[model samples]
Target: MRHAHTVEQVRAAEAELAGQPLMDRAVAGLAATCARLLRERRGRVYGSRVLVLAGSGDNGGDALFAGAALARRGAAVSAVLLSPEKAHRAALAALRATGGQVTTDQNVGLADFARADLILDGIVGIGGRSGLRPAAAPYATAPRTGLLVAVDLPSGVDADTGEVAGAALRADLTVTFGTHKPGLLIDPGAGHAGPVQLVPIGLRPPAAPVQALQHADLAALLPRPGAESDKYRRGVLGVRAGSERYPGAAQLVVAGALHGGAGAVRYLGRPGAEVVRRHPEVLLGDGRVQAWVVGPGSGEATVEALDATLAAEVPVLVDADGLTELARRGPGALAGRTAPTLLTPHTGEAARLLGGAATAERCAAARLRTARELADRYGATVLLKGSTTVVARPDGTARVNPTGTSWLATAGSGDVLAGLAGALLAAGLDPFDAASAAAYLHGLAGRLAAAGGNRLPFGSVHSTVGDRGEAPVTARQVAAALPAAWRNATAPQGGSQQDAAGLGD
Candidate 1:
């Protein structure tokens, strides 16, 4: 799994490494990465034009030192000091000694930047708040055909929250020191960062609040049946979804549940005929179940079904219409439940559940905070779905899903996701793990369905549909790809033997 540390956590690690020249080590790594980028972008670094937009902090010092290294290696390097008076003296002198050009003129810098093959953005750092300063704004605003590489992180992004307040310099590549920042992994800020390269300076932080699951992690958590396992032993999931008006929801939900590894699905709703017609494997009525999935096109019958599910003393996954009913009844309604509860809500549903100050806009803007607040308020795990799905537990810990694609915003997608999560709940995963794992797998399924291939992790050599040229996906296609997505998730970390050895056609 990939972990992201907040700014405060990074500072604590930096404090531990105070005796070491962390800055020098970071600069050396940065210089090496820049050199490699230059070689890849062009043919070589010897004759390439490099420009360092240096500010007045440690970030600028790192950039200047890197520029000096490149200049010594015969690359024509130039440093435009945003704060010339306050720029690191030693770094400036070293660059000058290596025959690197230094200037404070914005016009000259812009001209050089426009013609340069590579630009190192040290105009701002992780500690910086808001957007680019007036002097540095022009560089960010300028048209760029050359590759832009950021030192540490892309400027103008929230290092802790991943929110971009204003104009930010988007980088083609970012070489971050010590550990990965939260901004580099989350969206908005993640969108600004192209491919990130971690330069380890031997700094270790505490356990991260946010993490992204990988293949091996999912494989370890997934439930599998043994020789002694029967249908009931594997687990039966009860799905209370759909209505007379929306029978399609029932079929979709059952599809997700069956493919999600539930031994059997007991569906209870007015649309039983339509569900059975589509999936004969689903049982028409519920007698006993390991877990229950409530709401998703439930119409007016949601309150009754939710109450029945709540009284069972088993895990329950509440979504869509059920979220509205839960909101109307408030936290008091769920207070009696001894079993785990998972609440899945889109921004609008989350806003309604939160009420008053928590508008849909606010929930979308501050997703992490909203999910945590909802989880605390209802004493349940909150899986807030959006461009970035955040799964937050009642204890305030959260996991951010990075596997999703924009094409997942389709009709009945949430119904499929809800059913899949309920199956995981029945299979014995905790509310937190079930919700997080479901989101992770659902996202991968969506990407695979839409792209018609495996969607590799970020920064991998394999490209997305946009690069390969594919079309959009429907909800059914996403459900159909569930097994493939599961296999990909459960695959060995080193990759398949056929793929690695190129033994397959």
Candidate 2:
């Protein structure tokens, strides 16, 4: 059961629970939780201490209640009140009754903070609008500190936008109640919500306003070969990409499509001609294709060929220049078509299509809004690509891809992503699944390509290209790495297939 919720939605759910007659019934449940933590950290130094830095709202109330529980488990417990007179009366009373100390001395608090086994940051939650105020700022994660945990949501993170506010605490583990906020899964705000885990808090967010990707779901949605399947029946991705100027994009996107399980990839365009020259199996021009992958390096994408793509209409992946043209004139020119439309656009193209403010730094909230708005406006699936790629449904279920890797910051990668998405669309997966799986697998592939390298992370990022050298892989390298990446990312029971060893075949 996966759930994604916005801040206001989560807050409303928690508020309703608090209004229940049995609200205090679970106040003592914190002690049981602390005992479990104690069992998990048995042999480590500073294992027994739990610091609760609390504020004034129910968010702070959760920490104080938990602090009392830690005290009962023989761990030294302390609650440092940021707001002197405004702490939750009931929760503070519980902490005091359990012998948890409330200290006023700054030095003593600092010492407790430094030597503390774990820090429970209940300083703020979904209710937080500003940032770490003057009082709560001091305890933010420093270069050296113990594991930090958050309650409900991390302080200084916009639970809706996935944007970090003035000062955010970087948590090692955030134990949130009920469901995950959008910030916990997407970038920027995701940076601060490290390794989030949700605690069942007996309340459900309304409307299911947001969502996140998961591996098993991707695996299930991915196209797989069955009986009576042939190369043509499965799907053919006609790739129109690359040029003399960008000859590499054709190879990389094709590598991606091949690994993506496309039955056949029919190469097209001037770049497609070059791709057929390199890989003799690739056919030139269009034939019968279940999907079309257009605009990889299409600096000179002809209006005639693009029109053929629109006319085919099985499932179309619009990338690079194709994405740019679609953004400007709209895919409405492809009007009166019945096949699904998939548009994969980087941040700039998405911003242009949506006709609004944009930034490489724009939070997930804005991207999500853009995706939904564009899907509705253009009548297609909008895979808005970025550090946190978002795939939205016209039906209101938008999923943020969870698998991300920094090594994916290479050129030509988007083309390969477009290919993978196109193959899935042709193989008959839902638009939402096809786009999200493509983004997730693209990132996983980058990790595999650079698996055992130095600061390069995935592998030798500076290798040479020759008979004796391994070219520093471009997007094609990542696409070539897909099957292996998927194996490493999704192989169950600690086992793997050895069919692939490097980024490329």
Candidate 3:
């Protein structure tokens, strides 16, 4: 798992570190990274033009010290001091001793900034909140001729929430010290941060409040059927999805379930015939099943199926149309459900469930808060899907999925996720693990499908809208790529990825 520490956690860890200066350690790492980037961009660091956008505190100190190191290495380094009077005195003196020039004039700074080979952004640190000050705001919209690198995080981004209250500098890369912040791994702030590289400073942080599941973590959580396991022993997933008007949803949902390691998939909806036609392997008319998934693309007829699924006393996953019905009926609809229940909703659906206070805009902006509130309000595991998929439990803890691309925002993707998650629940994983693991696989599948059945360089890959060309994916294609994605997750390091189809234990 990739753990993300909060600002408070990072500060607490810094307080516990023994004799070493945190700023010095951070500056050393920052300088090294800057040197490497300079080499890559300008062929050599000795004659490269470097500019530092320094502000008031430790962030500016880190930039100044790093500039001093670069200046000593023969780079033409200059510091644009946003607050010259309030700058770190020791760091400023060190930079001056190393032949680095500093100026407080914004016009002169921007002129030097335009011709520099690299720009080091140390305008704000994690503690500095509520976006950029007026003096620092211009850099957020400045022309990007040089390679921009953020010190710890991009200025104007909320380190704890990943929200950008105002204009923020968009870095080509960010070198963070000690640990990854919550903002670096999430969206909005993550978008500003670009790619991040962590530099260890020996600060042992406490248990992280936010974490993203990695391949090995998903491998451990995935259910494996034993040698003696039969169809019923493995598990059966009952899917109540699609109607006469939307038969394709049934096919997509079943496609996700078929490749999800479920022993059997039983269709229980208006489009049962359509589902069987598309997938001959699927069993029609559910008998005994381990878990039930309702209602993607469901019409008015789905209400009966929802009641029947809930009445069966098995784990139930509610999605799409089912969510709308649940919102209309309120929390009382789930009062009699003794078994585990999972609710999957997008931002708009979440707003409906949360009533008037939680609008689509509000939920989209505050994804973590919305997920937690929805989970607590409905007393179920809630998976709020978006750019960053968050799986929140009733107990207030949550897991954020980091594998997804914006390409997964295509139509019928949620239905696919709902089916996949239901299969995991049937396979005996608890609500939390089932939801999280399923989201992990679903996201991986989306990424794989988006990349055209090849491995993605996730560390360097930017947003789906940028870089990658027009690669449209159907829901069926995403399902078809699941086997490959599964193998990629479970395969040992340095070993070849085996065909995931027919390989489930």
Candidate 4:
């Protein structure tokens, strides 16, 4: 994973760098790099004139300096001073010297803001808290003219808390200085920053981190089975899910697991062994497994089945009915596991698991805290799935899966996810990837499933949205669509994306 520095860590690095006289030149050099990016993309930069929304501090300084560099490249760059006399004097002066002017007149500024090629937000940084000052407040969510490049972070985002204050500007890109701040990594704040561009400013060694993940870096850490692998060697997954009342749960979970790349999946509980009747490939009565998935559609009687699954010497994925049992057991049962355990609880289950914690607090902080507190209590990885999925480990460095579409709130979907995740663990992927990839693909599957399915996340992917969409998506249809999802995630570049018809759009 890419190492991320917290706000304090970046500040210490800045202090050390700023202590050296050469650091000033380095600051200019970094500014020059941003200027170069602007210069090379000038037409796009100005076909969009750069509107620099300058605030009171160094964030504004960076923007004004960037404006100066943009002006030098023939792009019309103007700064709208929010703090008036309190603006960064040196950078403002430098911008003025380079023919980049500041305008305080509201009408004229608003007009320019409406038709600009790009707007550079210098309104806030790591030093700033959430909430907008009165003067610049209106622009927070107003219709923007073009792509926005935030200087450090968008205005009104708490640099430390990752919470948005009263109003916040949403940027297309944020060019962060020194190193990443906590706000640039965590959500509600991270979401506002959009994709980030980390620019080095000769910063020093790291400190306590906030958040980070590197695709290639983490990809390397994921376990892959070799050709010598066997069913037992490949890792076995035990699934104690579904019942006579809800047999599809078992089948879908099995479907998800089979494709999840597991060595073998063991069946337990009622209709589960009978699931082997149809999917006879699965062995009944778990001998041993690397991972266990229980509780999907187990309903009230799932307690015993869940208990048996939890007793294994393998990682466990607790979902649905299993989660309900886990809740009644309190957080202590997880501490007793002989193997690594993972909880795939949704918000309501999480609330039941977390007890009295406020819904917002749990939604905001539970993911990070769950892995720690629960891991410390139960020694397991906590993969809390929701609108904002957070996967935390017993070890630090919590990762938030960044890819999501609002299309995954469907019913019975969690069964597929539990199967997929358990399958990955059985297949030898680290618990982190097992959980995260399952979530990512779950969301992707939802997007594919609902493209023409009436735009409902849980309903079906079988609507007439596309004039001539190829096929309607059923459970089988969604199952068939997963290969493309896997391909997109594994593709080297931004691979050819398919439209609703499952054809290249």
lDDT of each: 0.83, 0.69, 0.83, 0.67
- Greater lDDT among 3 and 4 belongs to 3
Model 1: residues with Cα > 4 Å off, grouped in runs: 453-467, 493-505
lDDT of 4 by residue, 402-474 (tens): 4444445556667788888888888777777778777666555555665644232332221122323334345
lDDT, candidate 2, 1-505, per-residue tens: 2567876786677677776633343344434544555567665323388788888878888888878767766667898888768788888998899788897665666678887777788788687873688667776744435567777677888787676657788776676666778777666666677666556658766877676545555566677688999988788888777777777777777877888878888887666666766666676765888888777776765455567787785787777877777766764765676887788877777766666566435524466666777778788888988767878777767888765456566787887788788877777777778898888777667655655321123322211112122224467668777886565545562112221211111
Candidate number of the best TM-score: 3
lDDT by residue for model 3 (1-505), tens: 6677889999889888756788878898999999999989888899889999999888899999999999999999999999888899999999999889999999888888788999999899989884899998988887759999999899998888777888888888888888888787666777788777788888899888777676677899988878999878878999988998888888888888888888899997787877888899899885989999988988876789788877878899999999999999898888877899999999999999999777988887778778889999899999999887888898877788766667778898888898889888999999899999988888778777877865754331224444364267878878887777787788785112221111110
* Cand. 2 Cα-lDDT: 0.69
Per-residue lDDT of 478 in model 1: 81
TM-score of 3: 0.93
Error of model 4, residue 72, in angstroms:
2.2
User: How far is 313's C-alpha from truth in model 4 (Å)?
Assistant: 2.9
Query: 77-107 in candidate 1: lDDT tens per residue?
Result: 9999999988989999999999999999999
